[model samples]
Target: MRIAVTGGAGFIGSNFVAFFCKNHPTDEIVNIDKMTYAANPMTLEFLEIYENHKFFKIDICNFDEMENILNGCDVVVHFAAETHVDRSLQNAEDFLTTDVLGTFRILEIVKKSKSLKKYIHISTDEVYGSIEAGSFTENSPLNPTNPYAASKAAADLLVLSYLKCYRIPAIIVRFTNNFGPFQHPEKFIPLAITNAMENKKIPLYGDGTQVRDWLFVQDTCRAIEVIIDRGKTGEIYNVSAHQERQNKQVLFKILSLLGKDENLIVQVPDRVAHDRRYSLSCEKIQELGFEPVFNFEKGIEVTVKWYERNQQWWKTVKDKDEFKKYYKNRYPGL
Candidate 1:
């Protein structure tokens, strides 16, 4: 099988690449990535030795370039997008271009291809906005509160439209927040860990009461592999670890794991239109023989240890002037 993966250099994308390379050793993988600020080539460095793995540094918005590279691939998993909520809130143009328009370009190519077997779009549970009381099912109406979520929701609808109008075997899998290695330091878990590592204050937005379902990266990778093989066309699957916890709870856990004092946490201004809670009804995906084997406590420990031991790996980027500027811009008062 030939598989073309966009955004293969990003957080979840890089992890998925390693997962695919190990599980599908005989399959050809063409990893097309834009190599954005969040992506590092070192993540996929070992895969260079494998004959079945190939990397192409290209932007997905360039339809002509993507069309040329994706030809003859049996499956195209579109994971490319500008995912940071704070960045999107600051400026939505990038999200619209990369998340919505970029996806349209990929779908256009797949629409004309006869060799394509499936196109799996990686979506987030944030499209449903927030649920303070219960979980959101796949059929729930999309009420995206933030620009990033709205852009992803738009792409999701576009994918469904192609399925209906062009008869493309496209699938969408909406996953909750994922945490593990190779994740950018700006994200919640990594940010907290890295901040604690340097004895810096961990920024907590909006009272730190926001709730989220945290899923390990490996479990999400395995689920995506299953979806590529067994997921039905034009279907949306929701996957979660059901490890829902408030932001403060998770932060305290990080501090506890690192043997740090809780006084290092500071309450900061909240994100624009921040959702209070996000939960997903993963019954549909679970019905397809999906399960999350990693418990939250264990996963957090492993993740904390990884960052604790790899200070050099993260320091190279976190200590950079570029990242410093962005970080300051994102958290001005902090």
Candidate 2:
């Protein structure tokens, strides 16, 4: 099978490329990526020797570019987006353009590709907004609180609309917060790990009581692979490991694992309109015979070790002038 994966240079996207290439040696993969600031071409350096893998540095918002790449692909796994919530708060325009409009452009091309068997859109459970008491099911109403979630919610609706109005074979999967190797340090898990490794203060937003459901990247990718092969068209699947923990708890876990002092944590003002909690029900995806293999403890260990071994990779980006400038401008006073 020939599969096209957009945003294949970014964290999860790059992992997906590696996963697909390793697992299905005979399958051909066309990686379409925009190579944004968060995207690192070096992530896929190991896949360079794989004959079945191909990379195209192209933006999904450009219809002609997307069309040219999607010409003969059997499936399009759309993972391209500006996905950082904190960054989105600082600059929402990029999120809207890349998440919403970019998705529309991809869907438009899918509409024209009659041979396309599936279009799997990688989404987040943040679209369900904060869930304090219980998890959000697939049929739950969307109440996105931030611009990032709102943009993702909008793009998700567009994917469903195409399924209903145009009979496009599209499926959406909303996953929990993902962690593992190769994640940009801007994200919580990597940020905390990297900061702790460097003996720097790990900034905790607000009292650090906010809750998030965490899932390992490889398990999340496996679930996506299962859905692509077995999920029904026009269906929405919630992919999670049911591993919910408060932000403070996650921080403590990372600190304890690293044998670091808790005093290094610094409480900072929370992001604008930060959701207090997020959780999603994975019953639908579970019914499809998908199961998360990594528990929270094991996942964290693996993730922490990965960051330790790959110091050069994250270190290079962590101290770059552009990365530091963006962080300073975005999180002023931090």
Worst 10 residues of 2 by lDDT: 40-49
RMSD, model 2, all Cα superposed? 1.1
Per-residue lDDT tens digits of candidate 1, residues 113-148? 888999999999999999999899999999999999
**Model 2 segments beyond 4 Å from truth?**
none
For candidate 2, write residues 1-334 as lDDT tens digits: 9999998888888888889888889999999988888976568685697788999989899999889889989998999999988888777999999999999999999998977999999999999999879888999999999899999999999998898899999999999899998999988889999999989888899988888888999998899899889999899999989898999999999999999999989998888788998888788888999999999999999999999998888988887888999878866676
Query: Would you list the C-alpha lDDT of every candidate in the order shown?
Result: 0.91, 0.90
- Which candidate achieves the best lDDT against the true structure? 1
